[model samples]
Target chain A: MTKKTKWFANGYLTLVFVLLYVPIFYLIMYSFSTGKTMSHYQGFTWAHYVALFQDARMIQIALDTLLLALLSALIATAIGSLGALGIYATKKRQTRNALLSLNNILMVSPDVIIGASFLIFFTFLGIGLGFGSVLMSHIAFEIPIVVLMVLPRLQEMSTTMIDAAEDLGASSWQVLSRVILPAIIPGILAGYFMAFTYSLDDFAVTFFVTGNGFETLSIEIYARARQGIDLEVNALSGILFVFALLLVVGYYLLTQYTAKRQKAGVKRP
Target chain B: MKRKQVLFEMPYFFWLAFFVIAPILLIAYQSFFNIRGQFTLGNYATYFTSATYLRMTLNSVWYAFLITLFTLLISYPTAYFLHYTKHKQLWLLLIILPTWINLLLKAYAFIGIFSQDGSVNQFLTFIGIGPQQILFTDASFLFVATYIQIPFMILPIFNAIEDLQPSYINASRDLGANNWQTFTRIIFPMTMSGVKAGVQAVFIPSLSLFMLTRLIGGNRVITLGTAIEEHFLVTMNWGMGSTIGVVLIIAMFIIMSLTGEHKKKGRKHND
Candidate 1:
């Protein structure tokens, strides 16, 4: 890390971040523009935000998105932890590899392919198009992400910790509750949060499976974007953008603090 | 040994058998015989024989290939540059910031970027470049998809390159290998797995890209994804869509196996 190389890397990093965020920044900027003629600048006002708040459709869609994310993420997280347990318990290499492969399918498969297949699967099961079906599809995809995040934690988990708890007279459920859950809770939390975020934002499979009547925020965004975007939606997106940024900042600070503490502490083991 | 094998395998295989393999097996069965009304290979035959479906599958494949290439080209440099950064944690966050934003938001953001008087055209005007009002076409669709999926390509590559010991490069250079040769021979080969995984990550979604195609490509892009959507939704033709789904699954399985083989060879070479 010489001075010249340091400067070069830092400069490039700056450019990359700029590219990453510039569009969202522009969207935020346009939210306040008073003129309908889209331009770089205009008289600034909170009129758009005010209008956005009053829009019932946007609010309904946001609620729908939240509801879907909460339900799907909970189910996915439970199944994922269980799947991880089953995976970890399996000692044969071939069996473990096959399970891992199957779990990772959603991460690899093309969304359209999965969506189309799921549609067929559900239709075959005699399920009608509606909320229940949408929930099933969301769970199908969300479970894989949960399995991905939690499985690593399970693998890295100290076997002695679980053994110690069981030796202390904890039953299987008690062991899971008292030690295993606590041990990998951070990873599970991360998985659940990521799942919620994904389910909130997903459009592809949701697009395929969602019934005609129900709409999520992603669907709203799609519909708004398609029918020509309005500044009101721009303002709403800005508000969400700001909220997401704040949450990310908080998480970063929290992680950095823990990392620093971990660096400072004596070895707990 | 037999009992040990059974105990070791039962849970993992059971889950797969019931949850994953069963569904796929069902799909495979249904693909051959229409779910509700008929029983035959007519669905598969129709899709295979249709000139339109063949062209669309190729279009989807090539779209994915080009996107993979573009993502690798841009991401490798960015990741390479970031590898040398001191403030990596924050910088890494920035590299993956697009991923944190909702995918749909990012997709919509591109529309804002490439709209007629969008940011791109506005910048072009300021710089005295070509025509005004540029958006919504095959090119923009590809561009938007690339923009959305670039982070997927960068993360694994960055993480892998970060793990590479600097001593290897220094060793190569000390042995009088030039920078270009050292990078190609030592650096690239060592990092091939990450690159392959990243390429797969970027390419698969891009291959099945339907939302962006419909939105940005104005439904004219006619990808395999769009075709699936059209079949299952508009025309209510599940049989054709299922047939295409089987083809897609087979193609991906082939890619996975080939990559697995490449991975094995790479490991052996290193050994």
Candidate 2:
């Protein structure tokens, strides 16, 4: 490429990054503003943060959101990992392919359709929408993701290890718990984290299933935002944004550490 | 052991049958009926017959198309540059990091930036330009949607570009291929999978943007999602809502089939 083309590419990329991040930085800055509007940046104040903590309902909703995400991720991980293992072990290609395709239905379907269907289904069952339905909906969407994650790891593993374990008279349970589990733990963890974030960021699906007296943080934010913009949300958003960034950074650091250890001729646990 | 393995899968199968298969079937089934449990083709007919619904469908398609186009336009070069950079991982992380934040929060941030007295106007004013109304316009709606979707579009394309073997590029150069030729013949085709995925990721969500349209578009941007929300929430017409839901589902399938990978049948048979 010519020098002008190179300069143009660099400039274009820089501009894209600036556009991507400016609003985020703006939001973070305004979170500390004493004024209520976004136009003027007034003297810095901790009032929004103070109010965010003081709002018991918002705090409760945040906790509820985290708890729901954790529970759904945990359940989805267990079932999905087992499902992947079973599918991997299946002798018939058709059965395995069929199962995989069935799993993709949830993955491929639009979120709104999933949300709407869940809404109609829950109402039809006469189960009043609340935390329970929300959790179920989350798990339903998350399982396919977990399965896809773990399945790849399983496929990458060497079947010879299992055969060798069996030759040594190891039980199936022993082989699974000892060899296979340790090998695919990273994939499982990755799947869990991915599922957790999906649950955290989910609004469209949660919007339909979430009902009277139950609200996730996203739902609450949506409600407040639709009514009018609230500065308190900016404070909470600052915290959430930092929390997500830290999670990604921590995950990256963990992987780097493990990779370094492997490079140093240390065995992966 | 195989029997036990099959047994282990039973719960998942049941879950899929109930949650995944049953719910969608219920929506399809409900689409043909009115609120009073009377069987009718009225809901689908109403959707097909009404100008409002037709317009909404077109709007959804248009928005999805535009957002996808813009996202790819911005993301492709960014991904290509990042692929060649030494700090690829760090830059990629920065790109992916914001996506972890909630979509509502991002939309809220855009609201702050796009508001009448917001930073965009404030900055323009400082530059001697009049403070133009940015929020609630078609421009702001597309801008916010494109902003939210950019990261998603970038990651897939970045992965595809990163996975492209350097040897192919080198070979193209060795074969006297020009820069443009290498890009068009080698890099672009190799990155088609990523393009497909990125398009799917960005386009699908753009079609059904509910909160962004309401908060950012100020309800002026009436897409299919807005229509569905109205039918369910405001109109109390579950049948019509389900009808739209069914249509949306069909549209998704059509998009998938259009972009889906084809199997090489003769090669597989030979193998």
Best by TM-score: 2
Candidate 1 matches the true fold with a TM-score of 0.90
- Candidate 1 accuracy as lDDT: 0.77
Give stretches of model 1 more than 4 Å off: A1-11, A165-169, A253-266, B1-19, B33-36, B125-133, B262-271
Compute each candidate's TM-score over C-alphas.
Answer: 0.90, 0.96
Task: Residues A1-269, candidate 2: write the lDDT tens digits.
Answer: 57888788778878988988888888888899999976688999999999999999999999999999999999998888888887888779888888888898888777778888898899889988899999999998999899988888888788998999999999988999988987778778878988898899899899888888789999999998877668999999899988988899888987787557545634543
Model 1, residue pairs in steric clash: none
Candidate 2: misplaced stretches above 4 Å? A1-5, A257-269, B262-271
- What fnat does each of the candidate structures reach? 0.50, 0.72
Could you tell me how far off, in angstroms, the CA of residue B61 lies in candidate 2 after the best superposition?
0.4
State residue A266's C-alpha deviation in candidate 2, in Å. Answer: 8.2
Candidate 1 per-residue lDDT over residues A139-216, each given as its tens digit: 777777877888887887789988898799887778777877776676677778778877876788888877788878
| Model 2 chain A worst lDDT window (10 residues) | A260-269
Hey, what RMSD does candidate 2 come out at? 2.1
